[model samples]
Target: MKQVNVFLCLTVTFQMKWLINHGKNSWGIHSMSKNLDIMVKHLTRVEGHGNIVVNMKDGVLEKAQLDIVEAPRYFEAMLKGRSFHEAAIITSRICGICSLGHQMTSLKATEDALGLEISTQTELLRKLLIHGATIQSNILHIYFLVAPDLLGAPSVFPLIPTHKDVILRALRMKRMANDIGDIVSGRAVHPITPVPGGFTQIPSVGELKEIRRQLVEDGIPDMMETVKTLASVAHMIPNFTRETEYISLKHPDEYALYDGDIFSSDTGPAPDSDYLKMTNEFVVTHSTSKHCKHSRSSYMVGALARWNNNYKQLCENALKAADSLGLKPNCNNPYMNTIAQAVEVQHCIENAISIIDTLLDRGLKDEKPNQEPTRYGKGVGSNEVPRGILYHEYEYDRKGNIIAANCIIPTGQNLGNIDDDMKKLVPEIVDRPKEEITLHLEMLVRAYDPCISCSVHFLDVTFVE
Candidate 1:
């Protein structure tokens, strides 16, 4: 049709213009000074505030850091002396975006410490809740935070005039995901039902069936549309790759988000008990948050890492979406993280639906977790949250009270990797306009979806040469 052709031509023109403008030294930054010192305070469109500082002299890079400027909160210390019953409730305050994840991990750790086993129905509901949170988060990042950069818009608010339909589709998908969490966990944010051992409330069959119907009808179509949109702007993503160790939870049966052993791209697999060693967290002078490394100078986590580790476990629909987006496993490109997230949106939908059907076929039960503490000891719980792998460990006293606690957040694990990424990415784009270079660096950090507020907990910073 003539209208279709006109739209296609206009899109091509826009893409071409954007590429040309961004690829050149339009701002005369390269010529203005032989040395560059750029500081970005309080980055935008992400969950929390952080800074990116880069200093380059005469084309030689120097001093690149992703600074965690947020104030430190002693979350682990807060856990000490708290009752086992309140573990999940208090930990859920870590981040508004990842509240469910914190609650789930905290509960698992507490349950393990108390030597409790959950029911099949409870497990299924937890998985559904995880899927819902993943869907909610990935959709928010892909649509609201990441899309504007690819489409050359200032922000999602500016897109309302021209891209109203796409915005509505995204909002609808996010709402469905939030409702899924609400139905399972009693609230989308800071869920109240999923406590240690098991949930206090469970969804009825009628409610679950309606949720399933909506997922099948509304969720699937919107996801397909989202993939198409990403594919259109895929070219805008920089073709930069820096191979590094990828870490996440892995299982033979399925993509392990809910539970599994620790898996790293460099070092195959380790038991969940070895999480403390696996993290190898250390402090840096440039950051208040701790940085992580394992078998390399830096490593990466989150969706891209999970995809690389468990691509075989992805559902057929999700696999198709990945293939269509040209996203293959063993991908080293961090920019493709947004694409991987889009793929996961499809994967989570399929898995959630299957879980709902299984729950319905088996029937629901109003079971309470009647777990009694037999002994007191240490226990660790790790799961694949949206940002990446999250670990919570607790040492409980004989009286079912916490003595000590430690939580290794995903963004803390990722800080080192982001800094390393900046060191490599800056040189590649240093010849361009300084603003363009800054935008690229910011995009790289945003691709990780770093929750700086969630990460800056407690780290004894030590300055060294």
Candidate 2:
């Protein structure tokens, strides 16, 4: 009992020291002689790079700038002349992490242009594939990427030594989840199996049976254990109970992932067409990414929002697991997102299992293959990516060539909230040393799981002049 107290005390001391390492300066430092502006480009150590600049006035945050300097891939520009089938492939390459979500949206758009509605068998398969993507992305976000900071581990690699079994199970499960997405969507990174009308290739009975077998054999057990373990780790983070308005897709019958109506804490079910109206974005001089404000103001989405909006839609197994940890719908604590991600994984496996079983029950082992559809018209599509709502609007000429395209990425939609979060976060964490500010800012963005790399991506940090 005495040892526990010592450990607790030490943890608190370390947190305090980290938070105030950067001295408080109400005014930023500046040199005279025309205030030389140094062009210091922040080198991003992660896979995607963005930049942030801060002007400090006597140690106070005078200005913070975020930029996605990376040239916007002329993706939208490139889509003008491709076939609908080809455009789907091109769009899928936009984000490595969210390739499947893009695939589903682009395909749905193509189907709209062609006026095709697919079979239930195909729809169920798509649901399984996309849900697998969600599980894969969410688990990656929760365990390896997000948990390290909250638990005070520099990286997942370090945790392996102290918590070998727990970390290994998480890695293995995340790999398996990605594999499930790969099988149905095409590949884990960028799959082409989904087509404008349906899948380029349908699954064989044997293949689906194998997927089903593993769904129960390994998926549920791994996820259930994950929820139990991560919940324990989450209790250690400092000041994690900040409440924010939650937003996500809502379905009447189930927790919406791939298909559902939109819902949020501040509003009831919104028609799909009303999405853009709700997420009104405006530009800010300090950053290149468009800032978003909801109908009322800024709001947040992703796993936490979805879980809160649709907790009642969760299956029995998932609800029991979440409730075991004292989690419920309308959970406002943003820090609870990782737990929500884990809980959603449990629910995803269950949903996939149900979908597979439904397909198998039809008695028609393997369904028909995808062929170009005869229908043609304009269409809009949406699916929930790991981060938030992803929308696609497509137009085609009578000959089946693409004419216009619009895609609203989840990361883009979350920009306003991301900015607002930093507004609150910088002051909370800025008391720490200047060098440590970057790490704290990184944590804030990681919490939102932003995936965009601008031609010159925007990053925010307080800097001295």
Candidate 3:
């Protein structure tokens, strides 16, 4: 066994060397040796466990896939027989990073199923909370996960010594964003105040004004610095593009975060009720997380998708930030997702301030939640979370107990697209060093800002005939 292992290692080494020498073709063309294997057992700096597996033999691409190794969380099954009141609370545990997103989406599903109507004030506050969540999550991704690659560091830890100011700015922005969630939603990680119909607690007028002041005095300046920082390292982002469908929630009045219809860049708008049709989820042998495709083999559903589908809805400041960061509309490069996230940080800050001003003008309302259900049946809810568009569907009985549930996280939707990108990217960059190739693959996966644990809800069942 030892001798065989040695022979295998030597063969792989020789093949890599040969590829480095011979493989160099024009971009997007398979001009490499196409004889390599990469098994990143557990990728790092992302929210959950995922592996990048690629194999090419004899100039034919064999397999390129992001294998989700995380066990199935079964959040859907957990919701069965649960009460409408507990749905959001339970589903929010799916991810700590995206807990607020899950909570809000779950609440939307519950309210829709129970025919609960929320007040206008409730809508405004929820939008504020969403903006906070988006800001927090996007800033976290931009600084903690992706910055290390661009700055030539192993992780944010190493940069602490050299890039202390940059790191400090990241922490300050994150703290401010979390403060918004904490004040409005009752906590940042797993919000406690927001319920099916409305918030259990409302921020005072003083609190709203304070948040607005902080946004203007601190958030805006920090965001400007962030854009400059990202722009400095923008050249490090890979220049790769594979045109594919982009999907996100599209709102008519503003950039869709709290709610919108399902919009696809390829086929245009579809009702949120037709999400299953838009997703077209199917199982793949390579991944435990079910893959989704619509209007193509795969479609992306994160910041870049939102930018492509809803760029016109962005405020003027966000548009300027995009221009500064070189994030143009209709961008197909997956790496630009990080850039898009930065742009969103700017948007969320600006939007959050506007929401606060509106709330202040309307005066604080201490209205109780409307829990009286007119009906109970099927409903669906979706939001463009930090990672991408998240979905929750539920059916409730007359007694308000959940009968069935399904959740489609953005990470699951992006898995197939990541795989597709890998197939194209590996061939295009196969001539580079193996380490460089592996780094590119890792960066590509990180570009999606995937939350693997949130996505691994697929369970395969077989029956004995």
On a 0 to 1 TM-score scale, where does candidate 2 land against the true structure? 0.82
The positional error of residue 203 in candidate 3, measured at the CA in angstroms, is: 0.9
The better candidate by lDDT, 1 or 3, is: 3
lDDT, residue 387, model 1: 86
lDDT minimum window of 10 residues, candidate 1: 9-18
**TM-score-superior candidate, 1 or 2:** 1
Cα lDDT over the full model 1: 0.78
Predicted candidate 2 versus true structure: per-residue lDDT over 1-465, tens digit per residue = 000110110010000001222443431212111121111244243332344544444434444544434434556677877787697788887777788888887887777667777877778888888778888887777777777776777667888889888788777777777767667766778886777657667667777788878878888888778877766765654343455667688887778887787786786778666766656655444443454567644788788888878888888888887887666676755556666777888888998888988888885434444446676566778788777777777778877777777777666666556555655565555555555656655655566666523211233343444
Candidate 1 stretches greater than 4 Å from native: 1-34, 44-49, 452-465
Q: Work out the TM-score per prediction.
A: 0.89, 0.82, 0.90
lDDT of 3 by residue, 1-465 (tens): 000110110011101111223444563245444466766653432334344556666665555555434344566677789999999999888778888988989999999888999999999999999999889988888898889889888768989999999999999998999999989988999999999999899988888888888889999999999989998999999999999899999988889998889999999998899989998877554334456799998999999999999988888888999998888889989999999998888888999988898888888989999999999999898888888888888999999999888888887787678767876788788777667887887788778877533222111111111
**Residue 414, model 2, lDDT:** 60
Which number leads on lDDT? 3
Q: Provide the lowest-lDDT 10-residue window in model 2.
A: 8-17
Local distance difference test values of all predictions, in order: 0.78, 0.65, 0.79
